[model samples]
Target: MSKLRVAVIGCGAISKHRHIPEYAANPHVELVAFCDPVQERAKHYAGQYGAKAYTDYETLLREVKPDAVSVCTPNALHAPVSIAAAKAGAHVLVEKPMAATEEEALAMIEAAKENGVYLMVGHNQRLMPHHMKAKQILNAGALGKVLTFRTSFGHPGPESWSVDGRDSWFFRKDEAIMGAMGDLGVHKSDLIRWLLDDEVADVAGFIGTLDKAGTDVDDNAACVLRMKSGIIGTLVASWTYYQGGDNGTVLWCENGIMKIDTHPDDQIIVELRNGSIERHKVGAIATNEKQTASGVIDAFVESIVTKTPPSISGEEGMRSLKVILAAFESQATGQVVRL
Candidate 1:
C-alpha cells in the first residue's frame, strides 16, 4: 500500500515539537511538505524531511495534494487552514479548541463533511493512557454513579511554550481570543464529557487576566459546570501556577473517589467506600516542553488507512469548544449560561 502523504501547515512550537516529529516517525506516513509564513522555519523542516517547503499553505496544498494535513497554526487560523485542506481533498487534524469561535468550528465541520474527508481535532488528552483507562473504568460501572468531579489544567503560562516566548500570538487577543480557557479548559471539557458520557447543561465562571502582564488574554479561568446527568463539577484552567503546574482530575462517585495525575508516583488512584484502594501507573502525561509520542499522528494515519472515523471527530471538537464559549458568556454576564 502507498503511504499517506502528510503535510504540516505551521512551523511553530507545536509543529516542531509534536506534529512534525510524530508524522515523520509514522511508518505509514510520508512527510511531503511543510508550510509556514516564516519561510526559513518551513524550509528547515522540509530540508530535514526531504520534502517541499512553501510560505503559502494554499500553494503547498495545490502543489503537493497531500493525503492529510496537520493544521498547527494559531487558534485564529485553525478554521481557515482546516477548511482549505478539507476542500482540497485532504483529511485534517486540527489543533485543540478547533477554532477561535463556535461559528468557525461549525464551518470547518461543514467543509470536511462536504469534502467527504475525515476531520479530527488534536485533543491529545484523550489519547493519554491514564485517560483512556479512566474512560474504560467509568464505562464498566466501576465508579458507579458519578456524583461530582473537578478537573484542572494549569502551567506557568504559554510564554515558555510558544516559539516567540512571551511575545507569541498566544497572548494577543486577536490571535488567541481566549487564553487559558480556550487553551487548557477545552481539553478538560472534552475529557470530562468523554469520561462521563454526558454533555454540559450549563456553566458559570470567573475568567480574568490576573497574572500575566502585557497580555490581553485571561491567565486564569475557574468555572462551575452542571452536566446533563445532574452532576455538578468545577473546571479550572490557569497560566499563573508559579509553583509549577497541576494537570489533574478527581471524581467523587457513589462507590468511590477516583483521582488522576494528582500524585507524582501514581497516575491513577481509586479509593472505594468498601475499604479497597487501587493505584495505577500509566506513564507520564505528555507536556509541551517534554515531547512525547501522543499517539495522535499514528491514530490519524490508521483511521485514513482503514477509512474509519477518527476517535475525535470535528463535531466532538465543536461540542468541547461550546463549553468554553458558554463559560466565557457566563463570566461576562455573571449568570449561568445554558449550553
Candidate 2:
C-alpha cells in the first residue's frame, strides 16, 4: 500500500513540538506540506522535512492535496480550517476546544460528515496510559459505583510553552476567547467524560484573572459539575501554579478511593475501605519538553489507513467543549448552566 500524505497547518509550538515530529516519525505517513501565516516558520519546518511550504492554508490544501491534515492553529481558526480541509477531501485532526463556539463545532462536524472524511480532535489526555488504566478498572466494576471525584490541571502558564513566550496568542482575549478554562479545563472535562463514560449534566463555576497581569483572560477557573449518573465533582484549571504544576484526579468510590496521576512515584493508587492499598506504575504524563510519544499521530494514520473511525471523534470533542462553554456561561450568570 502507498503511504498516506499528511500536511500540518500552523507551525506554532504545538506543531513544532508534537504534530510535526510525530507525523514525521510515523512509517505510514509522508509529511507533504507545511503552512503558517508566517512564511518563515512554515519554510523552516518544510525545509527540515524536505516538503513544500506555503503562507496560505488554502494554497497549501489546493496544491498539496494531502490525504490528511492536522489543524494546529489557534482555537478561533479551528472550525474554518478544519471545515476547509474536510471540503478539500482530506481527513482532519483538530486541536482541543474544537472551536470557538458550539455552532462552529457543529459546522465542522457537519462538513466532515458531508464530505465523508474522518474528523478527530486532539484530546490526548484520553490516551494517557494511567487514564487508560483508570477507565479499565472503572469498567470492570472495581471502583464499585464512583460517588464523587475531583480533577485539576494547572501549570505556571502557557507563556513558557508558546513560541512567542509572553506575547503569545494564548493570553489575547480576541485570539484565545477563554484562558485557563479553555486551555487546561477542557482537557480535564474530556478526560472525565471519557473515564466515567457519562456526560456532564450541569456546571456552576468561578472564572477569573487572579494572577498573571497584563492579560484580559482568566488565569484561573473552578467548576462544580453534576454528571448524568448523579455523581458530583469539582474541576479546576489554573495558571497560578508558579511554583510547579499538578495534573491529576481522585475518585471516591463506595469500595475505595482511586488516585490517578497524583502521587510522585506511582501513576495510580487505590486505597480500599478495608485498608488494602494498591499502586501501579503506568507512566508519566507528557510535558512539552519531555513529551513521550503521544499515540495521536500514529492513531490518526492508522484510522485513515484501515478506514476506521478515530477514538476521539469530532462529536466527542464537541461534547467536551460544550461543558467548558457552559462553565463560562455559568460564571457569567452566577448560576448553574445545564448542558
Candidate 3:
C-alpha cells in the first residue's frame, strides 16, 4: 500500500511539538508538505523533513495534493482551513475548540461529509493512557454511580510556550476566539463527557482576564456543569498558574473516589468506602513543559488507513465545543445556559 501522504498546515508551536514529530515518526505516513504564513518557519520544517514548503495553505493543498492535513493553525483559522482541506478531498485533523462558533463547526462538518472525507478534532486528553484507564474503570462500574467531579487544567499561559511568546495569537480575541476556556477547559469538557458517557445539560460559569495584560480574552475560568445523568461537577481552566501547572480530576462516586493525574508518580489513586486506597502509575500526561506521544496522530492515520471514523469526530468536537460556548454565554448572562 502507498504510504499516506500527510501535510501539516500552520507550522506553529503545536506543529513543532506534536504534529510534525509524530507524523515523521509514523511508519505509514510521508510528511510531504508544511504550510505557514511565515516563510522561514515553513522552510525550516520542510528542509528538516525533506518536504515541500508553502506560505499559503490554499497553494499547498493545490500543489501537494496530500491525502491528509493536520490543521494546527490558530483557533479562528481552524474552520476555514478544515473546510478547504475537506473540499480539496483531503482528510482533516483539526485542533480543539474545532472552530470559532457552532455554525462554523457545523459548516466544517458539512463540508467534510459532502466531500466524503473524515474530520477529526485534536482532543488528545481522551487518548491519554491514564484517562483511558479511568474510562475503563468507570465503564466497568468500578467507581459505582459517579456523583460529582472536579477537573482543572492550568499552566503559566501560552506566552511561555508559544513561538511568539507574549505576542502570540493565543492572546488575541480575533485569532484565539477565547482564552483558557477554549484552550484548556474544552479538553476537560470533552474528557468528562467521554469518561462518564454523558452530555452536559446545563452550565454556568465566570470567566475573566484576571492576570494577563494587553489581551481581550479571559485568562481564568471556573464553571459548574450538570450532566444529563444528573452528575454535577466543576471545571476550571486557567492561564495564570505562575507556580506550576495542574491537570487533575477527582471523581466523587457512590462507592469510592477516583483521583486522576493528581500525583506526580502515581497517575491514578482510588479510595474506597472501606478505607482501601489503590495507586496506579499508568503514565505521565503531556504537559506544556514536557511532550509525550499523544496518540492523536497515530489514531488519525489509522482512521484514514482503515477507512474508519475517528474517535474524536467533527460532530463530537462540536458537542465538546458547545460546553465552552455555553459557559461563555452563562458568564455573559449570569444564568445557567442549557445545551
Candidate 4:
C-alpha cells in the first residue's frame, strides 16, 4: 500500500509541537507539504523535514495534492480550510473546537460528506490512555449512575504556548472565538461528554476578563452543565493559573473519583466508595517533544486504513463546540443555555 501523504497547515506552535513532528515520525506517512502565512516558519519546517513549504494554502494544496491534511490553524478559519481540503479530495483532521460556530461546524461536516472524505476532529484527550481507561471503567458500570462532577483545563494563557503566545492569534477574538473555552476548555468538555457518553443538555456559564490581557475574549470561564441523562456537573477553564498550573481533568462518579495530570506516576487514581483505592500506572503516548501531534495523526491514519469511525468524529467535535458556544451564550445572557 502506498503510504499516506500528508500536508500540515498552519506552521505555528501546534503545527510545530504536534503536527509536523508527528507526521515526520510516522513511517506510513510522508510529510510532503507545510503551510503558513509566514514564509519563514514554513521554510523552517520544510527544511527540517526535507519537504515542500508554501506561505499560501492554495499553493500547497494544488502542488502537493496530499492524501490528507491536518488543519491546525485558528478556530475561525477551521471550517473554510477544512471544507476546501475535503473538496480538493483530501481527508482532514482539524484541531479541537472544530469551528468557530455550530453553523460553521455543520458546514464543514456537510462538505466532508459531500466530498466522500474522512473528517476527524483532533480531540486528543479522548485518545489519551488514562482517559480511555476511565471511560472503559465508566462504561462497564464501574461508576454506577454518575451523578455530578467537575473538572478544569487551564494554563498561563495561549501566549505561553502558541507561537506568539498572548500576542498570538489565539488571544484575538476574530481568530479565536473564545479564549480558554475554545483553546483549553473544550478539551475537558469533550472529555467529559465522551467519558460519560452523554450530551450536554443545558449549560450556564460565566466568562470575563479576570486578567489584564486586554482582549475582548475571556481569560477565565466557569460553567455548570446538565447532561442529557441528568448528570449534572461544574467545569472551569482559565488562562491565568499561575505558571501554567492546574492542567488536569477529573470525574466524580457515584462509585469513585478518577483524576489525571495531577500526579506523575498516579496518572489514573480510582478511589472506590468502599474505601478501596486502585492505581493504574499508565504513561502517555511517547510524544515527539518537538511536537505532540503524531499520536493522533497516526491514529487517524489507522482509522482511515481500517475504514472505521474515529474516537472523536466530526459530529463529536460539533457536540463539544456546542457546549462551549452555549457556555458563551449563557454568559452573555446571564442564563442557562439549552443545547
Best by TM-score: 3
What is model 4's C-alpha RMSD? 2.1
lDDT of 2 by residue, 74-161 (tens): 8889999999999999999999889999999999999999999999999999888999988988888866999999999999999989
> In model 1, which regions exceed 4 Å deviation?
none
Pairs of residues at least 3 apart in sequence or in different chains that clash in candidate 1:
none
Per-residue lDDT tens digits for candidate 4, residues 211-285, read 844798888999999999998888889888876366566677778877766676677787889898888877653
Alpha-carbon local distance difference test for all models: 0.92, 0.92, 0.95, 0.83
Provide the RMSD of all predictions against the true structure, rounded to 1 decimal. 0.9, 0.9, 0.7, 2.1
Model 4, runs deviating above 4 Å: 284-294
Residue 69 shift from truth in candidate 1, angstroms: 0.5
lDDT of 3: 0.95
Which scores higher on TM-score, 1 or 3? 3
Tens digits of lDDT, candidate 3, 1-339: 999999999999999899999999999999999999999999999999899999899999998999999999999999999999999999999999899999999999999999999999999999999999888877888669999999999999999999999989999999999999999999999999998999999999999999898999999999999999999999999999999799999999999999999888999999999899989888899997889999999999999999999989999999999999999999999999999
lDDT-sorted candidate list, best first: 3, 2, 1, 4
Which scores greater on lDDT, model 1 or model 3? Answer: 3
Better of 3 and 4 by TM-score: 3
